[model samples]
Target: MRRITLTEVGDRAGVSRSTASLVLRGSSKISKETARRVREAMDELGYVYDRSAANLRHARSMTLGLVMNDLRNPFLADLAVVFERSVRRAGYTVFIGYSGDDLGDQQQMLSAMVEHRIDGCLLMPAAGTERESLKVLGSHEIPSVLFARHLGGAEPYIGPDNVEAGRLLGRHLRTIGVKEAVFLGGPSPSSARAERLAGLREGFDGRVELVDGGLTDSTVSSDSGSKAVSRLLGDGTIPDCIVAYNDIIAVGVTYELRLRGFEPGSDVAVASFDDIWIASQQVPPLTSVSTHAEEVGLACAEELLAQIDEPRQNGQKLIAPSLQVRASTGSWRPRKEDR
Candidate 1:
């Protein structure tokens, strides 16, 4: 099989080979019409660019790396999809690496990405990522934009406003007549969880009693939520409202309460974070905080590209969150005395 080359593309587009090469390299010198023609010709001929040869000649591999903690989480998965589309539109391809939510895997995958000569990285660090582990990329001068979680560094980061989300949930719970709220599932090592818990406390202004869910480790699952709630029940902590870490956990809590002959919305309200698809379709739709994963992903990608272009510019980007009211947590009007 004959391999299509730049010369063939140039001939098909009726442009000089130099012009076609410039278009392939994403050079700004080429006119829009000429670049479009060359791209069309290449597409028609099914011509794939030789990135390896180009990298050898030029110092750039023209590839970006995206390393996320866990793709199984629907939120992270959605972020990856949006980030992939945004970067691809910017004329750079992406290589996605999953850390499996382990520090060792995070470091290993980052090292591998560096070895592959990736231009820059978009990282969503694992739960327990330390400063030293992230130095692997920093020391190598590989630009990185941390998304969702950070390791308490000067690196650029973009994520939802977790504290604000927590506050919103807390405020909503209080408005719905939840004087005693229990947070089911977790003592996660992630900074996001701590910020969320803090915001929830702030929202209640020390008014609502927050009972510990009695979780030993950081695991966010339906079973974990159910188990935690069961332990709370066993401990004689009858919660007026149950707040789960995320929608999945909320679902478990709701299920467990139902099994115990309690009506979720009427008997005890339920609220959670990450207004995922399942949140709305539950037996009684769950009230949740909308983290806007897609927007966060777009911001992360843009920030990464900016860092790649000008590595000196680095800071944090916090996307605001909103509360989504549903049947699980009935809305109530604020009274003058309550205010």
Candidate 2:
């Protein structure tokens, strides 16, 4: 048997299709008797209301897309919570997608969000996702705010000042008389990573030497940190300090160091970025740079909502960084010869 049609139910109810539709939508304008008649007809015809189909007629879906590269990182997890809460309070639901730092997956998620007719999006683009690849959203006229990893261009972006975050770590390490250090984790060829490296270079500025232990993996993760430390141990060239791309990687770095008979703060020093909630909960606690994920997420959501309202391409937000000192990194005295 074919599916029951709303028009047939209207005919059975002795009412016009529009009036029946109003009754089905629970419009106060419809009389109780008319609504009851429509309901009876619907029950008789076994018709089911398709709310999504009804929503397609509206000017807005009251929905937003939230796409991220990774969820394992607590920073992103916290960001998602903040963004979702803010949007929800404004009467919007969120469609969450994780691309796992893959361009293909990101594209698929964007396409689906477009198909669903979401009003806007907040994206942390996957690694290697060029600006052109995200043109799908623009072509569909879906306003978006890029958070964390940006793909560049004049589109709206809300993220941390990575260079400043790096500077915070670098300056602290230098002040503590660190002579040699290693920067670990983070995906390569990334704007955020590059900025941090530049800031570190400036902060060190001939005061501290660095061991070139950049990305051992394509993306930032605890596994990458563990592998980088493992290789460094095999080389028997331990730096005075290790700076992680984020707290997730710091967990691995600190754990591996201790497992290999080296203390985190006493034997060597460890510092990281993204002052996640767990950063201060670690065994030694974590010395980190605060990206303020909550504020960033809220800003990004507000920016997108504004874009959806007025459609601006130049919207941008850059959050400042602050340092969180912890036992993981200890201040050392400068040696007489070095001083």
Candidate 3:
């Protein structure tokens, strides 16, 4: 049987198809009585309006697109959950796409979002994405907000205070007498990595010898951390403490250290960012800075809504980071070097 069309409902209610469409979409311009008549006609005729088609007529998809650099990262995953919940609560649907730190993939995802006609976008851009692509988003006037990471010279963003997070980690290590420290980081251009390095340097203040773990693309993975540890061991430059980019890398560092007969907290301290669930479940647990993933996600959603409601508002928003000290940093004991 052919599906009942909107024309049938309009004819039954003595209204035009356009009027019926407007009523079904709950346009405020339509009278309540007309809307009720249209709805009743639809119910009586078993006519189901195509919502997607109706949204297209309004130049809206009633959907938001979320792009992430790494979906496997727990922090990003947690943020995705928050975004999904918040968008759904606002009567919008969410579509997620992962770019995997690949510029080509990022571009492709952006193209897909534009083609799908998403109302707005939330992006965690891949390191080194071309500025032109971000500019295109602005040209289209599609409301967008970067989350967890920001694209320089782009629109507003919401993320943790990475520099502060780095400083906090550096200070904690310094307090524990970590004179030689290694920072296991991902890509160089990543806003998070740059801010964190700056903060760490500020906190250390040349008191500790800093080693670069050679992560140059925001690709925080166990394999990268393991390889970094191997390189450090080979170079005979083991630091008193290691600060990993995220929980995944931290776990990898801990595993490699243990395999090499080194105890994580005692032989060399370990700290990381994100404070992911696995951080606390590690053999000795990990001391980390909490980036508040859920809050960041919610903030991104709210910012997108604000932009849609009022496009003139502009500027970035920063979320503060909090430190969680755990067993991985050796019980936070104070040494008697001063005494």
Candidate 4:
């Protein structure tokens, strides 16, 4: 079947191709009557403009690229939804990619976006990306913004303050009268994980004992959290409270504790970051630091759009986390001794 083009629409409307282009691009220069006629002609002829070629000619793709560590994580999924809507509202489309925490994959995705000539990008970097990979994006003149996790060398980021998330969890545990807490998460290279740990330390003020229960990587999957629990038990480092990297990890910790004949709220309190939907549905609802995934997405979209309008802007933006108390953190009546 022959594809209908803008030229055909112009011919049908008794206008030139440039006028049709102006109408399609929503240029204010086109009169309302003319725009209506052009639009009617477009609908009648089934004209579909070659947006790709037009975008190339204008040096503006009207598209944004979004990269994340894993799309399976509920937090990232929610973030993606909000970001897509935000971009669409701003008259732009979005392209998303999952790097699976692989540096090579990150580089490949970046290269692909460049090939597609994306106007800007929002990246949730893989755990292992170095300064050099970030520099490549800058060199390409792509206005890239980091989301969820910050790559040290990236231009600007719109994400939760990891350190604050950790501190919130730590303080909650302490207020519940837990003197010892286990920190369960992935690798140290993960900026989110590292910042959360540091925040926890600040909250505890070196008064609480911390047991590092490391997992395979930064992915907050239930299985990884469960494995970390097993490792903690094997090392005889069980504590009065458990602070997980995120809600997924907290869920795993809760499940494993029940499997081992320990009640989550009574035997060991649990807290986590990212108030994902499941946090409230767990056996004992999870107490967690809320990173507001949707807000992060909106912020990233806004930042990218701003960069598109003003290319020389520089600096980073940090979003703080909110704390939510639940049954998982022993939110019931505190014991007499605890007071």
Candidate 5:
């Protein structure tokens, strides 16, 4: 059987299709008798309204896209919560997309968001997203705000000052008498990771010997941290400290050291970035640089809303970092010359 059409409903209601449409939309201008007749016809004919079709005519979906690289990271989980709350209060619903740090996936998800005609987007770009991939959004004139990492454009973005955060971590490890340190997990396409490494290089400048442990799996996971430790152990090189890319990696390195009969914090200090919730709950709490994920999320959301309101306005905002000292880095212990 053919699907019941709006024209049929109008015919049964003894009215024009436009009047029936206005009645179905609950327009206050519709007379009580005509509105009742249209609704009765719809019920009798079992007419199912297609909201998507109606939305296209009006031209606003009241929806926004929120795309992030890794949802497994606790920092991003927290960020999503904060960002969702702020956008919802402004009467806009969010369509979340996770790209798993893959460029193809990022492009596909962003394309879907554009096709859905979302008002705007908040993107935490994947590792290898290029200008070509983002052009899909540009072609549609869909505004986007980058979070955590950017793919290079004039669109507004909000994130932590990663270079300074890395420097902060480096100086903390150095102040604790670390003479040799291994910087684990990187060379990712993400600007955030690069900035972190650069900051660490600056912090340890002329003070400590820093070796790159290299990527174990991906730039942002504990598996990479464990792999870095394996490489170091196989090479018969163990530094006084290991600076992980994030708290997850720091936790992995801390346990890996324990399995090797090295007491973390005393024999081999471990530090990382992003003071996630688990950073302080480990056997020996992790020392880390706090990027304030929640604040960044809130700021990013606000920036996107501002852009949605005024498409021409675009800028970048950076949140400063803070150090969270814990047992993992031996911050409470008195520094003694061991060299």
Candidate 6:
């Protein structure tokens, strides 16, 4: 039979895992009636509270768990490989798990990692993850470090400094005399995109007007980029520059521009984030921000390992990003011909 998870108990009791945990520990914070509900739920589920076994869970397991939503993402794919080397050199093994960015899958992954008693966990949380969802880790006193995305609460997080990336692009645009820009972004309600835009505004210093491309829900790809740019052009909302969410999106934007007979480099400067492998291979080559994928992996491994040694972890480390300027954003000039 499978072990009864705290998440299941919490679900049955209509309380959070933290609340259920407090009931197990006899914490005074829980009301008598609430505690009764949790206790009864535990009894119904046949939970075994082996305190000694729980303590031994924190002992060296010589293994770590890594969870991510997507392995296809180049940066994350690179991170997986680099992070393994970083930890393996430190005399540890890593177990990689994919959550498909789904909340249910994430819950299961975390539970499995806990059951295995991995020494620590490195997480790139699924989209729409709440701090409450991470209560499972807390309930087990597991050392977990988040990367690439932040989920509020006091968890250690590591990711590229997106705001600085935006600043780099913005400053570059200013040098080229760009008075207006349309930012093509993916995935709505994203902290990274918001931070980048805020930095861009600061970099522009009120000199350049910013337009929202309004295509955040679609997957980041050449096709989405082409569609976003096509819609912008159809609305007669041409700008001096196009800022894409990533290299793939930028490629699409450039393709759509060429289809409309507008030269990407000469007529409209383009830039993107994530100086991926293909960024330099583009027709005019892309201008992008290098998040330094290997460095991010190393930094993330450092944090999770430290947290495993001591559970009280410092929160949030932002790795600096650098801009790689190329032909794409070099020589944009207003077209002489009218539409």
**Per-prediction RMSD in angstroms?**
12.1, 12.7, 11.3, 11.9, 12.7, 7.0
lDDT digits (tens) for residues 117-156 of candidate 4: 8888888888877767875566556778887777665357
Model 4 error, position 220 (Å)? 2.4
Query: TM-scores of all models?
Result: 0.78, 0.80, 0.79, 0.79, 0.80, 0.80
lDDT by residue (181-280, candidate 1, tens digit) is 8877643577777877888997887878886575634666788788877777777776778888888788889888888887888777888898988999
Best by lDDT: 2
Which of candidates 2 and 5 reaches a greater lDDT? 2
Model 2 agreement with the true structure over 154-209: per-residue lDDT tens digits: 76899999988888889999989889889888887677887888788788887898
For model 2, which pairs clash?
none
- Taking the tens digit of each residue's C-alpha lDDT, what string does model 6 give over 1-339? 888888799999999775676687676667899999998998999987878875665468798999987787788888888899999999999988998767899999999988887888999878778888887787777779999877755678999998898898898888778888999966656667787888788888888898878783446568889999999899898788999987878988999999998888888899989898999999898889998888889899988888776554465789999999888887666545521
Residue 27 error for model 6, in Å? Answer: 22
**Which residue pairs in candidate 6 have backbone atoms (N, alpha carbon, C) closer than 3 angstroms, thus clashing?**
187-216
Q: In candidate 1, how many clashes are counted? A: 0
Question: For candidate 5, what's the RMSD?
Answer: 12.7
Off by over 4 Å in 4: 1-58, 331-339
Which portions of model 6 show Cα errors greater than 4 Å? 1-55, 334-339
Sort by lDDT, best first.
2, 6, 5, 3, 4, 1
Which segments of model 2 are wrong by more than 4 Å?
1-58, 331-339
lDDT of 5: 0.83
